[model samples]
Target: MNHFKQTVALKDVKCFALHGYYPEEQLTGNHFIVDLETEFSPIGFDDELGQTVNYEDLNSIILEEMKITQKLLETVLKNIISKVIRLYPFVEKIDVSIKKLNPPMPGQIGHSFVKLTYTPTN
Candidate 1:
């Protein structure tokens, strides 16, 4: 049997976070781009908020987690993914990506990013 695939996405969620390997980053902070895509359980064609993914909840989770101080984008990404999976069991698969804009580094660079994908085991 094959299950129907449905996706819910939150894209280009820009936020400011104090996460970096340097002291200046922790002090001044930087802009980050966040994107979330999740594969959720389907319950027919009902138009119920409870039966599907709530994007508000997803946004809140990312916003809340981004405030905490972290040394690495990977850690931040991991934490967000873990929290989302734990909070919403209906989420079967998820991909989260974080990009640090204008990273303070040598040479010219656009941004640094970290992405992680999670799939539940049943």
Candidate 2:
């Protein structure tokens, strides 16, 4: 069901990391981006950073997860989901998107990506 209405998001978080199916692609890494959307408990009068999730911390988690080599993008995304859940339990829903800017595919293929949306149970 539904819970929260407000959202905290981070978009176009770019980084270079080792994640690919082939050894060459993994070794020479490529530009990668991770976008996030999270819905947490509504903030009251506290107005403190801790009251809501931190964008930088989320980026760091995404970057750290991307560094691990994986043959499939889903694996990377799964890692992020688990980490985020552990970090921010109040978050009711989350959307994490991972994009490989320069995929090693054929010519003209701009990028490849996997985006996952999650809604935790209360």
Each candidate: how many clashes?
0, 0
- TM-scores vs. true structure, each candidate: 0.92, 0.87
lDDT of each candidate versus the true structure: 0.88, 0.83
Query: Model 1: per-residue lDDT, tens digit, 53-116?
Result: 7889889989988999999888888888888887777788999999999899898889998999
lDDT of 2 at 116: 90
| Residue pairs in clash, model 1 | none
Writing each residue's lDDT as its tens digit, candidate 2 over 1-122 gives 65556788889988888788888987888888888889877765377887788888888888788778887788888888889889988788889888898698779877888999898655
- Cα lDDT for residue 113, candidate 1: 84
Q: How far is 12's C-alpha from truth in model 1 (Å)?
A: 0.4
Off by over 4 Å in 2: 1-4
- Report RMSD (Å) for each prediction in the order shown: 1.5, 2.7
Q: Identify the leading candidate in terms of lDDT.
A: 1
Positional deviation of 67 in candidate 1, in angstroms?
Answer: 0.4
